[model samples]
Target: MSSSSLPSSQKQVHLLKRPGRAPLSTEILNVVTAPLPDVSNLASGHVFLKTHFLSLDPSMRPSMDPSKKSYRPPAPLNETFWAGGVGTVIKSNHPEYKEGELVLSSAFGAQEYADMDVAATQRNGFFYKIDPAKGIEPREYLGGLWGTGLAAYLGMKEIAKVKKGDRVLVSGAAGATGGLAIQIARQLGASYIVGVAGGPGKAKYVVEELGADECIDYREANFEKQIASLSDRPEGGMDVYFDNVGGQTLDAALLAMNPNGRIACCGAISGYGGSYEGLKNSFVIVARRLTLQGYIAIGTFWPQDVYQAAIAQLATWLAEKKIATRFHFYEKVGVENFLDALKALFEGKNWGKMLLQVDPEWKGEGSKSAAK
Candidate 1:
């Protein structure tokens, strides 16, 4: 039977064959034989989605490989890769969801549909309704307000306990979450925001484009010295360090943290190859009264006042153009480009959020007018 005619029970998924050193290519053909999904097994409030856009992020790499010493366990050897994604409703067995509505879910099976327990999925506690109105781009919901932006805002504002007049330092300052963290710091009235990126261009963009107070190129041999110099000019030493890259960048931030400073340890992308070593200045935390907290973006803070407050502020910022988002679109959605887009992330090739344009039913206002 044609895919269109196939019952919702027979969901065709793109499966991973095995782990390999070769980059993602069209020839990695391990995908076949997906079982049909049953939404009826899910609870009354639960809903299933037709997969639309799968998020490509740094955390996805470890989830793809079995042998890596990942912070989070990889998905079972031959199963689907689960992560954050937005999808449309194909069948709704629940009252909370209806046919054709879009919702975000963690069910990462690359099939057309997935069944999830309404209360249990997002069991780790983070999901939101995707509104298509309000003039905010659909992509922005995936990028700015939903996942990356939420991580950045929470890490800097809550976990790091950042205060006004504090000098905030963020490494990996050009990536999606890093860029968002920089803006949140500014919005929170941070006295100074310092960003460390891979190259001079990214460093310049961090300061000039992202509105950071200072930017340092971490590729420089004397990067620590530059940070020191910048530290001296303003409020010396960092009061809050929002780190995305671990390793040398982390080491330097540790050395430069002021007394009583706090660090929000979000990810260790530097150790993506699994070669992270002990810090040279591990004792700094004790000596400086520093609070370095490792953060995992999962918790029970659903519909909490803090979450609502942050969302409200972020929406206002976007509507007012006080906060802007940049994105690179991948026009197609097969496994070939899927792997290529992911590889580009590790190479630092994308300037902004990398999005795959699957099911191009909704375009901007121009397309809507033309269709009419």
Candidate 2:
């Protein structure tokens, strides 16, 4: 559809307020109708876009709190929430971007439409053109191939330095990044791949579908025991630990690590909303001579060359069926449903990558039922 023919108003989910120690609520987000962006005034290297899917991730929860110190700035209150999304350009004035072209951007707001400046987007490090002929779905880019997948790839390959026959463990293994990280570990030739999740279903999916050798239910009282039981400790314990859930899980993984084991710290969702627990097993890191490294997928932390290399490899792996994509979709939901979808991340409700469909016409192939 053309920009001129599009609706004059669009729904937006704004950060109404920062949350307290409790889980996020509707009061923290304001869903309102806002003026559609005017693309008629063609600024050089700008495009008008209609968003299709907005990615829901645990990282977003911490970004909501202005007081929370992070690598990136927190979401400003009363502003349109920022997120990574896939969309199509309906109007364009850029040399590289054309109208009707599909694109992926990290700067798209939680709104139905956006006016993007390509030069500014590149300068801010947030835009990419999506090739429709690649046989990859737009939403997949928001998960394994582009979003969490890139993080998983970098965490495993670069940070953890995963090698052939290495025993690997990934926490939050049923979620987007963890799930893909398991598969990536397998591809990187992990002999014994162990996944840690919350329930039997997730554990089963992590093992049977995502190809983890074993999956431990973190909700079980014997969560640490299970990790020890499954890990090949004699072969230098778990060679690499890809940590997605921090706190107790990291502590447990630390206990199970072999001498000189490497840890790739991707996220700590366990302490997102001010709930944090000290790692009692941290002493083991020094005792075992373990290496722990924290990384961010974007910004100065990750090298641009490494990011590009990871993306190229991920695309090839995805196309060749070396890795699979799974998502827990919030289908046909409007901007008002944003906070609820986000809450699903912290609640351990989503089976895979959580996504919000802002475009009503975009039919998703994943589960329609919202995470309960």
Candidate 3:
């Protein structure tokens, strides 16, 4: 195959290794530049795609390992690894999709191009068409308005049962989900909001930027005691706890929660390594008669229409500026530094949403035509 005769090739970061319980490394992934694959198997109703941005969450780590049992399918080894992102339809056979339309991607991976079966993806409630008229950035669909927002919103609304005058406490407050949870808690009419973060900077960001009433540094010595010492204590201690990092933080929250408090268990980031220290204060659940429910945003929790309605509400808040979002973008040239960004996430380097901005401007044949 001569270079000119061969199809246009693009970059795809593929799964190379599974780290298991070990630390993440660049060696776990390999960037492969390859020609587009034949999608003739899907005879019709397919479209060519060009991806713009992707969402990187700690949950993706579980997707890389076959034995890990993540919410999404295991990313294929030596094949393009997919992350939820936004893309453009270059050409389409599906009636709902068309040429030059932005879409919430279900199959478009880290690569520059994809052949998506639109009807098939929509059936799974993953593919959504973006209305450019709204003037929303592609990345916004991956942040507080997308799965990131849904997790925070639904967790607070359905599981945490946060109500007006509720004193809400959120762990991992500086992270995308936690950050949004704090803001959403305030918007939900929580009279007092407390964010628990690892360091002073993150704590400050939680209060000063995300609008939490107070942010406690969990790293401080006897931090649980500090949480217990907040002045002007409400009639009841934290009425709701939005838990992200489990283990010690969760234990601390248990000690400070009011009787009958509700706990929304969103994530157990500290326990992802399979070595989380057991919680020492779990007896409070029985003594206080608290409600604790663990959840993931997809499946039983989010019926397609319900999720859409929640996202629409969040969009309204975003437009009204009643709630806001901050993003940490790794805008390296063409997804080349995805591994670096993933490493940064694990190191707690990002203060908000961790996003990958790949190929913002690719001058490939038909690329610009498709994006516009």
Q: Pick the candidate with the highest lDDT.
A: 2
- Candidate 3's TM-score reads 0.89
lDDT of 3 at 98: 74
Candidate 1: regions farther than 4 A off: 1-48, 65-71, 115-117, 124-128, 232-235, 301-303, 360-372
- Give the candidate order by descending lDDT: 2, 3, 1
In terms of TM-score, which candidate is strongest?
2
State TM-scores per candidate.
Answer: 0.82, 0.94, 0.89
Q: Which scores better on TM-score, 1 or 2?
A: 2
Tens digits of per-residue lDDT, candidate 2, 282-346, equal: 88889989999998887656667887889899988988989977877764477678888887777
lDDT of 3 by residue, 1-372 (tens): 112232467788888888688777767877888877553343488877777767778877778886766777787788887777777777677787877787886566777777887777767547888887896656677786777788899999878878999999999899999999998988888998999998999998889999998898988998878765542364668889999988888888887788899999998887665555687888989998989998888555567687778888899998888887788876464677777777788778888988776765643222332335
Task: Judging by lDDT, tell me the better candidate of 1 and 2.
Answer: 2
Candidate models: Cα lDDT each = 0.70, 0.83, 0.78
Prediction RMSDs, each to the true structure: 4.2, 2.6, 4.2
User: Which residue pairs show collisions in model 2?
Assistant: none
**How close to the true structure is residue 312 of candidate 1, measured as C-alpha lDDT?**
77
